[model samples]
Target: MSKQISEITSHEIKVEGKSSVNQKSSVNNDLSVFADGWAIDTAVPLDLKKSADKDYHPVLKAFLAGSFSGTFSTILFQPLDLVKTRLQNPSHHVVAATVNRVQPGMITIFANIVRQEQIAGLWRGMVPSIARCVPGVGLYFSSLHWLKAKLGKTRNQDLGPLEAVMLGVVARTMSGVALIPITVIKTRYESGVYKYNSLGGALKAIYKAEGLRGLSCGLGPTLARDAPFSGLYLMFYTQAKQSVPKEWMQSPSAASVIHFSCGIMAGIAASLATNPADVLKTKMQLYPDKFPNAFSAALYVQQTYGFRGYFKGAVPRMLRRTLMAAMAWTVFEEITRSIGLK
Candidate 1:
């Protein structure tokens, strides 16, 4: 009787083990697609998987990639940035130069800069621009990746439009606050107002003259411009990508084109929506004493340049911002994809 009971128990155990194996096999067979860099690969060695997981640092990689992209785009678009600064400048010289022309367009101003100060003059604030952008964009991407990871949407996962907006806003706000001082310096450097011989000299001058408040001159309007622009841009870009057929994205070139096009569209929309804030931020930063706060700055612009003052640098800004963002995203995506990050 004891032998019969033992045999029955062993048979039942064997049957359960077999059922579990079959279930696992069925599930594995059904999982043909990978998501979030994870897949059930029974054939892969345990040690290899461990190594892969251990070495993968998505946030760090995102920072590096974003820095590279920002450097490239900033260098390319510095001239446009300089022009935008000049156009937004309500300084006597800039206004006087444009006051006589019937249409003082971007091209005309660009040519004048080249002819007057030489072509290199167009990139007047390149050093500070690169300094601000490289770290700024790196921080933005790293924080974005970190936030997404915390939210359990890391790598190869599709974010909803709202999620994208929230992520963009939060990430950009962090980066903006971290780099506001550099941003003020960069703006002054471009405006041709301050004779900041060196970056250090500029910092000392501003600190000695205006103290902490000077360093944080345009904090409010900068945040207002960046947060909403980033949010709207991400929302629009994500929606555009989602609208494309998945089949189309299978082609690498098609995917690149789709991404760049979406970035441009997103940039345009965001730039237009936030142009007023941008104008106000530039005014506040350039003439902190003249326009002490956002309200006063806004009133000054309205009183001085009329209704169109808010969109002063609209053309160059739209072009530079749109192209730069598109290029940056395209480069960032390529770099991340090559490195096996999503």
Candidate 2:
């Protein structure tokens, strides 16, 4: 009887050991699957993991998409940009042919450029504009992507409106600082301040004339303008997208339309909020010697053009920014989606 009891106990111990080994093996297999980027989670489905999430070169893809979008939008809206720049330039006094002094409208400025500098002159700073925007937008998108990835903590990896604002502010601030030199060149090229025949010549001339400071003339105002603009735009855009019905987002065409509409609304709000900073940035970049800082530039605008001076190019700027941003984001989303990126 004692021997039978001993045999049963030994059998039980062997079974339990085998079960423990199987359990450890199962855990090891699960860990391996997770390391291979496939995880079994209760909240997020396995198939819902996008190709973009698995992509090794996400930042590079983002940059190319952003560059393509920026190029298309910048070229399409170059005329509006030129008009806005001309309107804001303190040097260009738009005196009417008649005896009365009046603030020139976009039509007046557009007509003047066509009449005096020819139709081609409407694209005055095309080279510099492309230079600044292509890479600038690329940098912005890539950095924005990186930030979202780093900061996102939700199961779906989504950002709230406030988080979106923070991401946009940080991303745009980095891009703005890195591209301010090109921005200054583009502004000068548009302002008709420098007479260089080529982009290279213009860059060389500016560097020689004012050194490094010349390249970064409007850094402060540029940051002030771009950071808040991007922050507010992203916040508004995110909220608008969330407000959209899930049914509407199912169709690609409907989604595109929704994105564009949301972008325009967001751009309008952000542009209005940041127009004063933009005006200051342009003024300081165009005449760095006269207005060395944002404060001085503010004073100059207030004294010269009064309360409305801060919004000198508001009309053309609003139009250009609204349309350009809408188009850029639309194109960017399409391209990224096509390339299997989210």
Q: What are the per-model C-alpha RMSD values against the true structure? A: 7.9, 7.7
Error of 2 at 285 (Å): 0.8
Candidate 1: tens digits of C-alpha lDDT, residues 250-305: 88899899999999999999999999999999999999999899999999889977
Per-residue alpha-carbon lDDT of model 2 for 1-342, expressed as tens digits? 999999999999999999999999999988877877776562334564474457648788889899999998899899988999988973445665423767677788888889889989999999999999999999999898888778755324557888989999999999999888889888888877677687788778889989999989999999999999999998998899889887997889998999999999999999999999999999899888999999999998899889898888988899998888888899888888887766
Clashing pairs in 2: none
**Each candidate: what lDDT?**
0.88, 0.87
TM-score of each: 0.82, 0.82
Whole-model lDDT for model 1 versus the true structure? Answer: 0.88
Off by over 4 Å in 1: 1-56, 97-103
Task: Give the 10-residue window scoring lowest on summed lDDT in candidate 2.
Answer: 90-99
User: Candidate 1 at 62: error in angstroms?
Assistant: 0.7
Output the TM-score of candidate 2.
0.82
